[model samples]
Target: MTQQSATQGSTQAQQSTAATDAPLLDVDVRATFQEQFEALAASRGEVTALIDATDTSTFAQLEARTNQLARHFQERGAEVGDFVLISSRIGSLIMHAAIAAWKIGAVPMPVSDKLVQSELDAIVEVGSPALAVDTTDRALSVPRITDLSAADELSADPLPAVVSPQLKSPTSGGSTGRPKLIVSGAVGDPAAIAQLGRVMGVPENGVCLITAALYHNASFSDALAALTLGNTTVLMERFDPETTLVMIEKHRATWVYAVPAMMQRIWKLPDDVKFGYDLSSVETFFHVAAPCPQWLKRAWIDWLGADVIYELYGPTEGQAATALTGAEWLEHPGSVGTPKVGEVSIRDDDGNPVPVGETGEVWLRRGVGEPPSYHYLGAEAESAEDQWETVGDIGRVDEDGYLYLTDRRSDMLLVGGVNVYPAEVEAVSDMHPAVLASCCVGIPDEDLGSVPALIIETADGEVPGDFDGFLTEHLAKVKRPRHIVGTTRQLRDAAGKIRKREIKREFLEPTAQS
Candidate 1:
């Protein structure tokens, strides 16, 4: 097994390399993947690597299974640098294939199995995979790796001892007008992986539970952190609040990584329900992907203690740029944390640095010597100014250098003269016991210019009837959503990201100038 010494020199050396230069830092990433998998198999032996309602695979068993499936993919005409479409219920097979695809220099395109056929068709059309491993026996001509492969009929090839590139594919957002694919050429950087492992405090013997969708970057990256950092991962097919609680105890999971929504769902579990399970083994509860409600943040701190919940903010385009410890969160209630070691700056529209307390667009330039390398499939004109790029989030930094994001600059609502961040209002509204979920948006109002309107999902247990009087107690007059709407209407994506433009069209489009 190849092991690079976990030293400061290695980390600095890794960080110094330009982002566009090497796919993986120093070591052979493919070899690293195989070695770690083998190590996991050796150490864990028969311990489960993944668990679902109908399946469970021990670490040793999963390694063997993945090896066999890797052979199948090779036999079915899959070659190095080909995209492999992975659309299946999240399980050991999908997890195994992701590693296998990486080993063969194939990029794993993990798509949601829950997506409508049209959406799947759209992705498959554009992703253009060499092989697709789908669970259902459909009419699609792509090669499929079935459950029978777990029996292990083939010997595993010695994974490459040199790093290779898997053309960086962007996460497509269909809701924001046209679907865009952000092509990032940089392969999985092992050094960055190691740094993240340090930030996550991943132990050599740790096991992580993935409660979020595998299609999302955070879930995939967190799972990889375990493998790359020499730890086992327990994959859950789908996030179930009760099942997640049960599995945390059943697997004796050490690290828990999930989105705030998933955590809130777990928080929704009755006190008696949580008491029935033993999750004492869990050491870190990490939250990322979406902006978490402050109330949910407080509740997590209250339930599991402050040290348990750590929040990180970053985008798929830039990777995780900032990490805030729980204690740091107390010092400043809204700050995300200081900029990452490789990151720099928050700037205004005129490209000038904003004052400490003034809100502006978050702009980041890679550390010295980092090169400019980003590709977009649909949008042609690229934005590159001396290796600096902004991800369109509006935020401000405090005197101490902590960053606080207001909202997506595009989504900010200008209410008369008072600029309002939808995220802040939504965060506060989400804390209400009667509210299952809430999305705050500004709607055109003659009286207040653009007034805050909240679309809410009412909790089943708490006030299932009236929302107005219940909302009054929790919100201030100005911040209180002037208009309240039910969430039953198609107002948000499956990920719970509010479709503000869609909602705005429903309410304001007709009145627009023709």
Candidate 2:
């Protein structure tokens, strides 16, 4: 079928199979994630529910595994409202463990599998989870499950359903110090989950592709939403530009979650290779987590039409969100779209509201009478007296009500009393063809107080000699980095986020000591 025709058909199917209207088994607000899975399993028994590199599993198989895992957690003395720390890599095992935690009325807190001992200890200290799921032999005060084999040994029979008070507890470090667990406020209610799916454009019974790491909030939430809709979810063990396209074609995925970095890699693929995949089945291509470059956004829109390309901007706290389609983006250019779920206001340092088109700290709050969406465990939230919270982001709202982000408040630099957003400088630096990645941070300057310094990862491992000239056209003198350090090492993490504070320390600490 033609691309347009396929999209139309997919949309119609999505409408007909809206999660609320579907004949799904009745589930209450107190119903566990396992109970929701069981209902889907009974109705969509033979349908493939999950796909990964190793193999595929049907809803029935997934349900059975979840039940066994739930029993294992219970046998280990896990109880309602407890937190289970999952430090394993992305796969069906971790997914099953999360559901199992929910089944026993416990929350699942996922930590990066690659975290070092020190990092792991810090998070464990903050979360104080009931149990830790890790393969490595690490002696700790808490009980540990070395592998899923322990759970596999248990019976696969169904367990009594019980929902946790919170759906999940995801970690976020922001730009400051240690990571904090942002515990979700709401429980795992099927109706609420369905409504979230509809808002996020996740089609019922559609194929959802996940390329981002499951540890990230967006990836985890989107995957769960897809599963909640009885949609087939394809999880990539790791993201490869070409492999992502291949999987989407193979699975005929209708919805997919991606971050800006992933999109850039795919867009950088060879023309012939990138165009070879049949991504016609995709109805909604959702991207979030990081700011997407204008060029990359336009390229994807050109490739997949404006209607299918979508972008979302929000924090994991769920206080507010903005969504923009490619068509709307074309008109607004860099805008991330208007506030959809909550109110957004720009405020100055004194907590006073800013006028339109002026940059300031972006604050968000839920609609009137709506309760706060999340609470932090390890760190305090930055909020005004009126309860509008700022996630340390800077942005401005246009006359048309669209929001355009500048940079993280922590990453802003003072150059001779003029503010410089690292994102602005980094965006220009990334436009250079030889630069693979760029990180801009503030460094101490005697004259200017602090000036921007750039760390660049070159594509060919050689610093471009003309880097200074490249920025002359795009940036003003104050906005351009005073120092351009080159390295073959990547500056951004897998999720396209740079630890600006960490990078700044690495650059400044040695100089200060000297």
Candidate 3:
């Protein structure tokens, strides 16, 4: 069957299943976050709600702890809609704090716990959160609450359930520019949470695994969805490729979230070791945050059944989303799937819609009369008329309305009047057996205006001698890198996103004045 017809069939099946299986709860989308939790706890009180490698907490236990933390936050002068900056390593404690903030009607803004004081300061300067929770010894101007132990002395009795006006304020990865807060438009509501859980295919009372950092939007959302569905969520403090496989087997995880970087690492494992664990329990293996190389995606589909592999494409801003199963992806190869929630339009510089198969800036719009799903704190969104917004992504839709991404428009290289998208080059490079990770950036060239420069992270500390031959065979001559650099250091972040602009600066800084 064609991709479009197959997708439509799948949607109809899902809707039918949902109508039959899902309970008709009187869930209020406007209900407070705390109220939602209280309802969940009452229903799934004995179920294991959250699990780390070492510790597990039931829904009842988690709700009680969150209530205690809510009182602590209140004592620290955190009021409704107050942004609480949470800077701590991923653990059960961070989840408790986030829920506690929601309980007391405070917004949680999670930043990377490993960030230096300067990086923390920049985010604080922009967000100006009312309370700061950093286990580290950094002094801050805001009221500081160090660890979960601080709430140890507080009462565990349930506090008044309250809801924040804003659900969360997650920061961007700062790949292309400065880190900015993307505050969610929707408040903490039961209906919204349930809808997200359904959309992500999170099952009730099932086991879910999250390997990415809690600071990342994808991980955070996944965790929340799992918890909302009363699933047993296994939180990994940090991603270790081998450990990830072991955890899946140990926990019998039915659903897991990963990025392409993590997948590549696992794919590199010895065949015996990689296949040693029983991964048959996994029903949905969802990957997002960055593009998955075609080869990598195919390998995964081959390893796991196509029905178990799923891909999501969307920004954290929640404006729209597209998703596809591996079976559907095989039919539509590079497409990110048709829009599941909103409309996508490809437009030229003049703001006119382009023909099918023509590349242009990809703009997304929610249903008619829908407001922007998010607003920026440190930067404004790139928006045009009638709520059409682009996150600077460039892509095209085929005749079947399946969207295929090129690269970010800001990351495009102008090479002698020909456009070169770094993602295309990097995707090709990542296919090489020796390459662990790769990044492509545009470097200044006097003759051609600019040219592509490739930076590779090899499997070992050394690059293969025939690396150029691999590139020549994979990429066109114009798209080939003019300069190649290799390092053992990783190129992508935990979420598998590359900071091409930052990498380009390192090569350009010395000759910038010349």
Candidate 4:
């Protein structure tokens, strides 16, 4: 019955609408992904559809370019249901390449722009794309599109309309070294896409600024959402703390997609430097990727109005999700808020529900017998007898059903019999004036199994000799780091991940990078 309703909506949404509202309806329509751009071009040809650091493209320009590019992709063997891996520099061309893939009814999978050759091999073995786009001109396993101009001469006429089997296939934490493709199950269902757009705070005919790298699924997907919803999208070629503020004011952006790492950089800027730009133009400030530090979350709430800040927590698996506006966050400070969709519960290892407020594995159930929303390529989900599934995240719920995450089981260290999660330790240490970003990892210990260690990245590249003493006041004995170290190397990847496993291997072991 649900499938039938979606099918009906897709059929209805494809039919042309009346004038004056056609451009608006074009964005609001429910059809194949390419139809959104095609409709926008037909009715609102002159409107700016995409903007990057160097260039901007109108809807009509994008439509024609993508059409030609789509033919080029097909000439290279990309067809409906084939994968098109896009690993390119940050720019409008990246988005155009993605739109081209969608136009050809192929799944578009964006990976880290700086993917190492080793990482590329593993992903390509699993992805098996018909073609790959790398503007960096690196050697790849599949047919590669090295020059963007090569596609310009292809015919710009519309191709036969076809829907992608899946909405998109984004590599899970690709930039952070975990390269699993998360294949969404939705078949471009019009209603589902519309709801996702709204959830990301996209407003019709508004400007959406994207400050982070597009390879991150959340960042890119939201940009796609803005375009599909008939909004102007501004993509930053690279993220600069002050420039983000400048772009928002310049574009008068109504919606912005950012993660916690970007927020910290902007926050660390001197008050005068940060306050120099006009940020009153921003409306919806959406952040996700990892659990936000309490101090940082509160700081943003105080800077921007509580009503404007929003957060989401869930795995890419799509089994569960929890969202809260900053206003709601004030009521439950550490909680990620009650479920906006999908039923969430804390379960013991036996899969039985734990008492409220008891920390346990967090599980989610969309429906008892409903089909899965996503499938993984390189990883498998831990699921219970029912439809409930978990991605190894450990958390709890309050009496009011608000969720609070402790940490992921993989990242939690058994510290002398007591579990120690790094978020709390890093959160406390980040409050120091000298610290820019900090990552907490459990160092192997003979007595305690693993002992917590502090590794910080500072703006001035100076390691505070007494920083451990500063943490002494904030962290408990069990959570306190036994050793403190600092590095000039970047701590988090573009996906806003600390990558504890990688940090333990590389940072702790000096020979990794050199």
- Give the top-scoring candidate (TM-score): 3
Residue 457's lDDT in candidate 3? 88
In angstroms, how far off is 80's CA in candidate 2?
A: 0.9
Candidate 3, residues 321-348: lDDT per residue as tens digits?
7778999999999878777766677777
Per-candidate count of clashing residue pairs (backbone under 3 Å): 1, 0, 0, 0
Candidate 2, residues 117-159, lDDT tens digits: the string is: 7777878889999987775555555888876777777888778
Better model by lDDT: candidate 3 vs candidate 4:
3
Report the C-alpha lDDT of model 4 over 438-480, residue by residue, as the tens digit: 8888877778888888788886666787787888888899999
lDDT of each: 0.64, 0.78, 0.80, 0.77
Clashes of 3: 0
Better of 1 and 4 by lDDT: 4
Q: What is the lDDT of candidate 2?
A: 0.78
Worst 10 residues of 1 by lDDT: 14-23
Name the better of 2 and 4 by lDDT. 2
Error of 3 at 13 (Å): 25
Clashing pairs in 2: none
lDDT of 1 by residue, 1-514 (tens): 2212112354323222122222223322224455666766777767666665567777777667766676777778888777787767755556777777765666677766766666666666666778887775443545655554542667754445323365335356654655555555456445545545555445555788877666665676567667655566777776678988888888788888777777776787788996688878878888776777776777777777777778777666652267677778888887777655346456666666555577777766545466434456555522345555667788876776677778998777777777787887777666665566667777777767787877666644333454666567766667677766664553334443566776767654554322
